[model samples]
Target: MKRKYTAAAAVTVVATLSLAACSGGSSDQPSATADNKPVTLTMSTWNLANSPEFKTLADGFHAAHPNVTIELKDYDAAQYATLLTADLAAGTAPDILTMKNVTDMVTFASGGQLQDVSDVKLQSGIKGAASYKLDGKQYAIPYRIDGNVIYYNKDLFKAAGVPDPDGSWTWDDYTAAAEKLKTGLKTAGSAALPAYLHGWNALVQNFATAQVPASALKGDFGYMKPYYEQALKMQDGGLQLPFATVTANKTTYQAEFGKQQAAMEIMGTWYVATLLQQQAQGAADKFAWGMAPVPQRTSKTAGTSNTPITYGDPTGFAINVKTDQAKTAAAKQFLAYAESQEAALTLAKIGITPALTDDAVVKVYFGQSGIPSDDLTKFAWAKQKIDPQNPPSPKTATLNTVLSAMHSAIMTGSESIDKAISDAEAQYKNQVG
Candidate 1:
């Protein structure tokens, strides 16, 4: 089903721009610097411009094309998304921009804001390309692929006499472990907490098989029911963070876990870097921790047509369709190199897992990187799998707001499940109409 989300995207453009027109030249065409004059191309991202990894990549781009200058439009991560949308609405979107995930890419693609790169080179063994495609057109240059994980305190599990998790672990196993941790564990602050929710949106994405419901505004949201029910079961049992408590604290789950207040959390692969840093520093609050595959559906929830699955996606750069031909060509070339195995190796050497699937390249990065405290990244290698993601309805940002509010209301005892779901669907219809 296709939806046109008008409110969240820039509605109409007085000027239509393409990164570079197809007629500009061959695919490998460089930006014109015919008079030996410098041509500068802008790349926008939430990453620190001077960070070692970015510096390495940028330096290599400049070194190879001495006539070209790379200007970084780095912004604070917290404000970058809002600023990016504002720039697009203002007709000042950069030549190349970093997108957070498939949702953000889909929003832009719906508005004809991203360049179609289906013609670009696709390297063998590179991964996660499908997550960034919309309507059969490639809208983003895929980079790193990340999957859901259960990051837990191993020492706490041992203290509670609960076994460490494995791939075979199911929802029943998770619930049992959480119950054990809740009853047996006490934090340094003398309060008892069983687990934390690292990300709410992740709860929406990490589960679901190929199924479509007749009336989910976007059929893609069909998976919301079982996952939400499972999470609520934990909340009702006092095994999950209270919505009121979490909102009052206003801190990341990482902060709560660092204080030894939580025994476990379900989060994505991005948290691995933080875990690596803590183990490397020998932080006192950091205890032995391990990673497990994100929980799978129990037999009770897995219908004959449904198979348990985890979600993985690419977060990377895309060319602005509005940029000039020369800059567009340059942007395409730069992304081409960045997605190569060579660039993947460079990204991985610094502990950033690349989207490349070469076993040799993956081994090089995971061999010593402290991603998992036990230095066992093999679990991650086996657990991670990427698939084509859903193209969110144009009203995604609005739908997310509605879903989140409804969930919070139900969790806090402010609304009944029947009332909340009905209200959410009604709002979805009215707002997305």
Candidate 2:
């Protein structure tokens, strides 16, 4: 997701660029400065107090390389880009910069603030690594990826006598299942919602792009119509919560699915961590649950025999251009370690989906306590194709802004799908063209 930069932050960046013209580019520091001596490197991260991924990676890397200390500099997740932009302008940004999405990487790269990390040999399993490349030069490498999947309450399905979802389900199959679940659940005297659709625009826009092609995001968004129609149909049928009600109540998907109020939810793999933590803390009820491949756009793409398409953004790390040669070397080492097999295991054990995953990583992930180990769950984890939610483009930010507004209008019944999409296209041409 993109965050708006404050005027002050923009001003700071412009001022820095002007000053940098007088001061010249970063000084060339030779690798001769690097040695086996102890060194401290700071890396930017978000929500360190609550999210432990950064610290876990840092500690694990430090444990293996005793001479290096990786210090984490935390910032508010919602305001991360704005704050990081300010820091970059002041020349006080962390030695290692954590890019939240492709847009942020583009911004940093275009500003000439990020070091070219093309030399870092990332694992082949990291599918989203190419998303960080611009002009044939790599800037960042992903450590973890959060792909979308259909998370279902197995116990709830059994209670309602509804069949559990498999890799073969298409959007039509999904709708039929939801309709059946709604009827069966009511007859069984259960109050659970058949499905829960989160309020985020990604819920609709990202799915549309993945099922079709991301290039649609750069053109007219006509590809999103059918998806919107299905979502609205479900909402109106009471198979899922209404967009307006969810927005007004500020409902969370965690509570909806965790409390058994929702039988199925389409969410990112990152929720695996939250659910496990909540169950352990007694915040969520313990029950049998598992993930399935998200419904496919067509029957041809809908099965274990075929690779189901889904959308997600990768979180990666980049190095600041101004860091000393010694720290730069150390920072690169940390990046390599972060995507290593050992690090993948550490992330998997904590319910986070590592980018560098293979059969071994899959074994570690399912072997973790409280994680479902059923065949369907394993299938969901092992196979699928992920498309970047945000494709690289200078005008991507404007396109997303237009799509988000279009999503809200259609989902809330404020405007017809055709009308909303039409308006968005006009806005896109006006601002992005």
Candidate 3:
């Protein structure tokens, strides 16, 4: 899933931009028809880097709907929201666009830019329309499921005299192995993405004991406080390295993790396929790394369930309300086909977990070639934790800004954990309320 500044932060941006109107409506509504008239629908997305897979999906959609043409527009992660906001304001936004969370859907839905998709049944045959339902109405479909897993270097584990992690292992066992591995290696025991950037994982992992349930908010920050506290304890206990040390001068998560600089990296399963591809090309040895669930919390009252919870980042297509009705209906048809079983399978081959809820379809889709059977099983197992309704915080973007600064302070020993949390809470309240 594409991480925006969290829902907490995104809400702040929306609030900031609320001063201006973000969409326009045309008086003419084109009639829907099965006519073969050529029509083009513009679609916007944030993953230009994954152009090949996206183009494949687009082509598949076009093939299914011969009369509708899709114009794919790519935007960098940082530039997408700003450009999209501008487009919405000028009444020239794409007919379909990608959204990260409910806050995003609400932002556009409230602005009257998105068409009501509640009545459009998914052609993919997935159950539970609740995943796409927002405020009593449906506006988008769940396209992919993403989650974080403990990706360990198998070679490193064996070298450290630690046994490989089985699915049944507990957090204590994980920490024991990590500590043992850190003794002989130059690298730290394990590494995690910066807390602010990974607030979604933090929220999901701590959902049970959280002051607020994961479902209460449009994004996941309400449950992140305890998660960060756990990280701090782990850092003090030497079970994991400080974020600053691992991230220092590191431009990308893959670069650092790929070099074996960290024995374990908490990352999404989507990157597993890419890593496997790299390993095949001899970029790295056939390391015996495997994924396991995050460790359980120490206290029972803490309510941290080790159900192997992870973050789910589902990207879907949404129609712009400003578009002509004929184009809108055609766009919906294209979206339905794009989200079908065949298209979903094509996406799964490229490491995206198909959003279709049917186990049979998912099995057939991942049963194909290019991806390892073991990895496919792992992906399928992880998909059970997919929580499309619980997206990252809209305040995350702003939280990330604060987190970046706070992380610097913590690593430098310039600020205490209590101070950091207090400061972050203040900023979060300011942004959201």
Candidate 4:
């Protein structure tokens, strides 16, 4: 999800820097003043892969600050962490870096690699900023929030004589709908992305459950057991599809949903835009779709789990401790600009719900595009359900690896649910410890 800055944007930034350097007479002095030198900053980010939206934002930055130069670098998601670590270790990290979550920010802040933005106005521009803060120090700014919602094909529902999914849909209603849709699907039944084991999907289901407030898990070490049980039930139900009939070949959930192979899929806001694009291309003419809050265990309290809550992993901008003071100031200015309304709007156009709270900007970008304007706002509400105490972390990788193995055993009828839970608990405790 890396994007590249355009050539024109690069040239504009360099020219701005050159003029600032010439006027200032030296790079040693602070670059911020009513008059004098310009500042040069470097920003590293993921999701810049030749995207026009990024270019527009970069160009806007140059226009706003005639003396500042901002250089943008894109990194592949798989290589970003490794490259960032190398940069930090070599004392050559970029002035600003993007962190994946509060967990990552905490780890880096603890390691003394990030600059504290506690005093910056940047906090006001970011949405869900509180979630990224640990103990009182703000280490990152969230640019967008994403959460899982049930995306169903309207055409398929109608054809299968299933009721439309709405805010009141219950888990039983959902399963029944799936059973109805299953009768007509090319495959034997519905499919859940295998990637679900990695906290995102499981956490979503956990929040939507009737059992307990997801927030109870925050800081409570033992709450994950119920979370695991809920996930196990969903998996057990989904596995009834024949191995050959269920589709899991695609690497991404969006891809599988886009092909209309799955009657319903659970995904974040990004998929809504992807579906819009497919519709525009006539690839989805036969399908009609809408987003509904994820189903709950009962219809009476369907909205009780925390309406409008979303699960978002924000990537933050941090400064390398070893970077020079001048570079640090420049980087801060660049970070500020990136979080501005103009930049956030550009991101929203491409389906990323901006971390900023400028509703007008959000409406402007999403209004003409025919996207559900309320969906983003609703997701903001949904984010409340995210168990801040048990928010997904790197440990989730190991937890999922074990869950996958246990799930395989369950699918083969080699283990009972109780045994699977016990085994998973043992494995997680061993790995986490």
Highest TM-score scorer = 2
- Lowest summed lDDT across 10 adjacent residues in model 1 is found at 1-10
lDDT of 1 by residue, 1-433 (tens): 1111122232211111123333322325443344535667777755452234555555555555555566666655556667788898888877877776567788888888889988777778776787677777888877676666677787787777667765556676788888877777753233646777643543543354322222244623445667666677887788877767777777576666766677887766656665666656765265777766656665432322333355666767788889887677677877776677766776777766677757666666666555453433355453354444443446556766877777777666798766776787788778877
Q: What's the number of clashes in each of the models?
A: 1, 0, 20, 22
Of candidate 3, the 10-residue stretch with the lowest lDDT total is 11-20
The weakest ten consecutive residues by lDDT in model 4 span: 7-16
Give me the runs in candidate 1 sitting further than 4 Å from their true place. Answer: 1-39, 47-53, 63-67, 89-92, 184-192, 199-201, 204-223, 278-284, 299-308, 373-377, 387-392
- Higher TM-score: candidate 3 or 4? 3
- Residue runs of model 4 more than 4 Å from their true location after superposition: 1-36, 50-56, 101-103, 122-126, 183-211, 214-251, 278-286, 297-306, 340-342, 368-415, 427-433
* Candidate 3 stretches greater than 4 Å from native: 1-32, 47-49, 100-103, 122-133, 184-226, 281-285, 297-307, 357-372, 375-381, 388-414, 430-433
Residue-level lDDT tens digits of model 4 in 243-334: 22333442445555666656676565556666777777866544556677765554544653444343445544667677687666666665
Clashing residue pairs in candidate 1 are 20-325
- For candidate 2, what's the RMSD? 7.6
Model 2 is weakest, by summed lDDT over 10 consecutive residues, at 9-18
State TM-scores per candidate.
Answer: 0.79, 0.91, 0.74, 0.73
